[model samples]
Target: MLKIRNLSASIDGKMILKGINLDVNAGEVHAIMGPNGSGKSTLAAVLTGRNLYEITEGQVTYLGKDLLTMAPEDRARAGIFLGFQYPIEIPGVSMANFMRTAVNEIRKFKGQQPMNASDFMKLIREKIALVEIDTKLINRSVNEGFSGGEKKKNEIFQMAMLEPMLSILDETDSGLDIDALKIVANGVNMLKRPDNASIVITHYQRLLDYIVPDFVHILYDGRIVKSAGKELAVELEAKGYDWIKNHDGDE
Candidate 1:
């Protein structure tokens, strides 16, 4: 569903992603494991066209369309959803209103009429149930005063509402207890389909245990140095990143 070829990016004239080549097929989950400052987040920002990063070289194709050329909203409208590590708070915007706007906007982009209030509400109710999110939270301002776990659940709620073709989860496992992590992972798993995919960027293999990846990639120093299967993640957890660093001749 997505193809990235020799992608390199920089921010404020400082290089971050050196060269990244990844292909994600529909229905597959790809985990990117890396140490801090290894550019995992930079890859997400570049894919979403977040504006801070400049693509120094290479191309990204999404469903045969030029993904890098599209604006952030366009990317979202085109079935790309990003679950941020730290979800932003919109103090005055109710979650319901925010999500309604997003859903209707994507619908309009697809040349469909905006859903009636009744239909929209029904749709949201179903999605909220799917994510096991509290309906009361939807009536409150987006992410406002939410606990860390609540914020992460809110992100998954948005994902369930949008039903994106490819979801980029940037450290979705960060700052959560085991139970909260399970809830979030279950929400993601429930959303998976044969035509949908996920790119899970995380630092630890603990999250991988809950959301087993089809492919596990080790990203180091702005590039992906090794690609393996689920067992690789367990090995990494046991051996730590130094093994990969040394294997890649970085130490």
Candidate 2:
């Protein structure tokens, strides 16, 4: 569904991603793991069309179109969803109002009529149950006064509702207890379909225990240094990132 070729990006004239290449197909879950400042989030930011980063060299093709040229809003409407690592608060905007607008906009992009109030509310209820979110939470302002776990669950809830083709979750497990983590991961698993895919970016192996990616990649020094099966994550957990650092120098 997505292909990246020699993707190089920079911020403020300093390079972050150098000669990075990746391919994500439908029905696949790929995990990106590395130490801090290894350019995991930078790659996500570049793919999402953040203006701060400049594409120094390379091309990104999504659904066989020039992905890098599309605007951020266009990207979202085109079935690309980025679950932010740090979900910001939007005061006074209730979740129902926020999502209703977003869902309708997506329909408009697909040349469909707006969803009626009755069907929209029914869809909302179904998604609320899918993410195991409290009914009252949807009435509250967007991420306003929400606890850390609540915020993360809310993001997953939004993802379930949007049903994107490519879901890029940047550190969705940053801060959460074991129970909350399972709930969040369960929602991701239940939402998985043959026509969809996910890019799971995380630092720890614990999250992998639940999501169980089809492939695990070790990114170091702004490039993917190693790629392997699920067993790679267990090895990384046992050996720590020092294993990668020591091996990276050898190559």
Candidate 3:
């Protein structure tokens, strides 16, 4: 569903993501692992059209369309979702109101009419159950005063509502306790289907225990040096990233 070729991106004048080539077909989960500043987040930013990183080379094709040409909003409406590492707080805006506006706007993009309040509330209730979000949480301001786990769960709740075909979760496991981790992972797994794919960007191997990616990639310095099955995550957990750096070859 997504294909990238020799992708290179940079911010300001500094280069990051030297040359990344990856392909994700429908019904597959891909995990990207690397140390700090290895361009894991940068890849997500570039893919989502964050506007800071400029693509100097290569191209991305999403669902047979030129993904780089689409605006960020267009990408989202086109079934692209990026779950942020640090979910920002939107004070004074209740999640219900915020999501209602967002849902209507996306519907507008899709040439659909806005949903009535009755329908909107019913849909919200159903999605809230999908993520096991509390009634009080959705009525509060978006992520405002939420704990780390609450914020993360809210992100997945948004993902469930958006129903994106390609979900790029950048370090979704960060700061999550075991219970929160399981909840978020279960939400993600529930959203997975034969027609959708996910890119999980993470550091440690623990997250993989729940998500269980079909392919694991070692991204170093900017390029993906190796790609392997799920066992690669276990090996990395045992031997550390230095082992992959020393044996940088396709596995």
TM, every model: 0.97, 0.97, 0.97
Q: Write out the backbone clash pairs for model 2.
A: none
Model 3, range 34-80, lDDT digits (tens) per residue? 98899999999999999998899999999999999899988998989
Which scores better on TM-score, 1 or 3?
A: 1
**Model 1 misplacement above 4 A:** 249-251
Q: Write model 2 residue lDDT over 1-251, tens digit each, in one string.
A: 99999999999999999878899999999999999999999999998998999999999999998999999989998999998999989999999999999999999999999999899999999999977778999899999999999999999999998999999999999999999999989999998999999999999999999998999988898889998889999999999999998884321
Which residue pairs collide, candidate 1? none
Kindly report which residue stretches of model 3 are placed more than 4 angstroms away from their true locations once superposed: 249-251
The true-versus-predicted C-alpha distance at residue 80 of model 2, in Å, is: 0.5
Give the higher-TM-score candidate: 2 or 3: 2
Per-candidate Cα lDDT values, in order, are 0.93, 0.93, 0.92
User: Model 1 TM-score?
Assistant: 0.97
- Give the 10-residue window scoring lowest on summed lDDT in candidate 1: 242-251
The residue-by-residue lDDT of candidate 1 on 1-251, one tens digit each, is 99999999998999899889999999999999999999999999899889999899999999999999999999999999999999999999999999999999999999999989999899888888866778999999999999999999889989999989999999999998999899999999999999999999999999998999999998998889988899989999999999877885321
